[model samples]
Target: MPAIAVPAFALAWWLACYLISRDPKRATLRWQAAALVSYALGVAAWTMAPGSDTAEILLCVPALCWAGAVVALLPLTPTERRSVDRGALALGAAFLLMIVFLPQAGRLVVLAPLVGGLTLLWRLRAQVTPRMLPAALTVMTVLCTAALGLLLFTSGGARAAIAALGLDLLVAGYLVAVAHAAETGERLRPDLRRALAAGLAVVVLAGIPAAATMFLVPAHDGVAALQFVVLAAGATPAGLGGQVRRLLDRLALADDGPLRSDRAALFLNADALLRRRQHRRLNTVGETEFLRMTRRALHDFADLNRLARSPLTDLPSVERRLAGREDQPRARARELRAVLRESVSALRPPGPFGTTDDWRYYNVLQFCCVLGINPYARRPKTDGMSREARLAADWFRRYVPEAVTKQWIREGAMIVAERLWSEVATRRQELPAGPDGAHDTQPVNG
Candidate 1:
């Protein structure tokens, strides 16, 4: 049963990795999925190994592979050239060689990866901000390392118990790392928090039957007690870490403007969300709904460019590249229009113009261009617009070409959506809101 179950799990995990890797936008997801595949393969090896000296030595192969997977979870630095898979494989091979040649020093081989991971974590401490998640992961890693260490040196019933608990800790540690990667700086949804809590509750409840089984078999290894304790203890920190961090954020006394770290985190999340949404099929009904969806797509498009400015690598080079690309403004205009057409067509709308707030910017830009009205002409008669909207309109008319202005409106919509998603990063607190609730700041010129 163990043999079958383990390999089945490994296959399922590898399948997921392959499926997720098909999407280019899911970089982080791909990295994680690859790591999971490596880890699963290692587990499968360990489970299938026979009871012999050769088998014992062969176990180190998977052990190092699992360590490589753990190392893959670390965030990449800006200057880092090697991909995570390459790095993981290189490390795995190095560890494999050590264990194979020095069978007597197998325990040291097991310890090597943990030390390397710790060192990487230490070196990356400064790079990882909104530190709570990383800290929790660190604690879990340390605990798993300790458990693995004990499993290596210990014997008898203690060894069996430690092995069980250590495996549990390692699994729990991976969960923590994945969760931390997914929800690092962003606020976790309430349902997710509750789900985590419920999972922990289930772990605790499972301990009862295990303990009863141990009681029935008095001479057996005390695996039940270890199982109960490990499950109960292992889940607490992983679940509590986010809850506590969120609480502290809410209670924080000073409102230091959103940090660079926050912006970077937001950029990552926004990009991922946009990419995912781009691939989704639109299912809106009626012209109004279609226009609304179009507006959303426009906003997403603009936000992508705005957020793209903050690359993980050299910022100046990125900026220069973007600037140089703008030399072909007409080409950009065509591309933007193509994107808009693709998104708008998906909703099967009754033309781009509609009698709704969603059509306001689209109508204004279209009308101005069709009439060949002086680009700078301001319509004071438009009664519904707030001061910010009026200013934006004026800016559009005076300096922006009609096609360019339309593109900006699309981008502006994305900025607005981003603001709605997380006001902390998007809102300029010093600037007052215009009558239409638009911030009175310079419009994004993209």
Candidate 2:
């Protein structure tokens, strides 16, 4: 098992690292990463002490991690971290004995969290949309339910196989489903397809040994049977997920655009992620992605890292401004910041600010996204601000729909993009070109 696990662990962990790095602020992704790491560590411990007390103790931890990880993936709205997770910890305690003494009962141990997660899903049914990888989730729900049901007729050993297989199928489908959902603007997690191919490679590496263990090994010992479960969960073999892809061209999470549940988090995770995101992907940004990126840039207002990563920096005005120094992110960042500030200033009305429909866009952008105010917080740090900033903060907390704030950001982005193009046009007109400059050779996008 150790010989086979070495490569599988490396690949899975690599994929885990990539996903977490891409969306460091996503609380859900963080939990998922913890689950994967905990499961892998349990497997490593078991292989080192194939049937020892140490391995048994180590194996117990993954089950707890899974219990929590499954809950974190729940379709939560813009809620705080502690408030949402208290139940998972309580529920984990309820399953403590089974997870400890009957660790070999893989199906039953996994069933607790699976059932708990589904129950939470049921409660949040209103949040479920076809976009959150309904097809893959539907398959997962059916297969795992069926496998657990089979425990009535099957023996204990067979339960291990049933649970192992279910875990294998889910890991692949769930992660891919999450990634696909993210790509479609369904979830806040950065696109998982970034490392999915390597993820599939992990399944291939671990599947053979885990499958062989299921059929040939004696499951009489607790550690041995539990070892296989960890291997299965860790690799997240791609069998059923492969079939899911071929059968239904459906996989994703729901609309996680700023509107989804990000309101509850108030884009807090995104703000954290932006400050850390230094890598710049030079892809063409559509209006929606453009708005999302720009809004995040403002959320991390003083942090040059976010502005440096802004797709708005790709503007010809920005490019022309930088000339040969386009590679300097901070320099580009400075210009992007200037453009954003100008756009925010434009949101100001002709007279003193008032909490009316006319002032909605200004209030939302100025306080929520740009100024980083969270009035709903226990202690809003509005101590030294002007009366208008305070009123705007209160108005945002009381009046604005979380969803509408994102649209305001979109409008703001449009303003900034137009201003950039306007600046470019002005430059094109002013440039004293060479003799044959009759040809309009100015760059459009840059």
Candidate 3:
């Protein structure tokens, strides 16, 4: 791409974003403007940098700085606002300076600290909102772009390739760490404390294996290979750590499940009363209805007091509820049950799959179960016994038989697949019917 064209592209992008920002309905146009400007500035950095040498690397710093700046300026909780702003500003400034003066080596060093620090600070604040996450992601994009540009500029061939792979793993690992933090609602400092402890454990786990790899290979690249192994391992847990954090969150909020909340029932009851008054041609129906609604609200409130409360992660009881299958213990099933119990606690009501408001929790449990069943394949946990157990594990007394669990997931997956295939199938059979006809819609094999 020509150098002049880069700036032109930036200008056009900024204008588009600015126009979008003007519409009150799209109030987020301002952020979009920031994103566009950041993009243009980064492009300008590349176009104007010394030669064509590592232009992307140089540009990444400014781009990321712009992204970080945007995120920092957004409304955040007082505590979160302070930490995120401090960390983002610190990293953003450092990266920008590196872009200006030391484009080459500064790129690599900038990413490790910038991402690591932001992850630490964001987690420490224990704050997350839809806006906050997107902003954080934008900041992350800056970090990644810089790192990739640096790798492209610095090395070539096998060395560069390997380094790029390593960097990718590092980014993935950091994301996992961030996820862990989000799930736990742990302040950055507390998460770091746990990470440090886990790091020691990782060191122990890898010590001998790494040593053996080094000794057996006895080459410089061997050392690199060993290092990669450790990083990859660290990264894997960092990814899973977020999940554990979410589980912890579920456990804490265990008593807050939907079945215990009477609001839905109250609404139903009040609606019925309103209908009755309308039929009687009551003159003060509106005011009377309001009072009745309020009364119903109070009645619903009392139900919160009525339900038996217990820790969602009271593992033994959850395990017992699921019925301990003597067959290999279904480690996946048991673990999933623990997670589901937590979901039951965390979910609000009117969930898509679970018992209302708990849909998101059901979604998460299903994801974990699918991961356990077919780690190689990515599938939704929407159908099957997993979904059933996820819905009922905390509340249902019956054990989810192991075979039922597996069959449910399999059949559910099959039903979905068959229906999709049937859509495209030439001699189409009716989309296989589920037991509940239109509602169940799960396919049965002919």
Candidate ranking (lDDT, best to worst)? 2, 1, 3
Q: Candidate 2 on 1-446: residue-level lDDT in tens?
A: 53444444444454455545544566555655555565455455545455444544443444455446546656554444356688777776666655566535452564566556656756665544334543444455565445444532355533353335336433633554454233323332333442455456655665555545544654444644465555445444331232233233222324444444334233333333333233323232333444445555666677665455455565555666677763555666677777677777787788887877677666766777667777767678988888888887777677776556656665665655455445544544565654766423232331
TM value for model 2: 0.53
Worst 10 residues of 2 by lDDT: 237-246
Cα RMSD (angstroms) for every candidate in the order listed: 19.3, 13.3, 23.8
- Model 3 residue 123 CA deviation (Å) reads 2.7
Candidate 3 lDDT for residue 300: 23
lDDT of 3 at 45: 34
> Which of 1 and 2 is ahead in lDDT?
2
Which candidate tops lDDT? 2
Residue 90, candidate 2: C-alpha displacement in angstroms: 5.3
What is residue 322's positional error in candidate 3, in angstroms?
A: 54
The lDDT, on a scale of 0 to 1, for candidate 2 is 0.52
lDDT of 1 by residue, 343-405 (tens): 333332255334345555444433332222334545444466555455545655665565555
Candidate 3 at residue 25, lDDT?
30
lDDT of each: 0.41, 0.52, 0.37
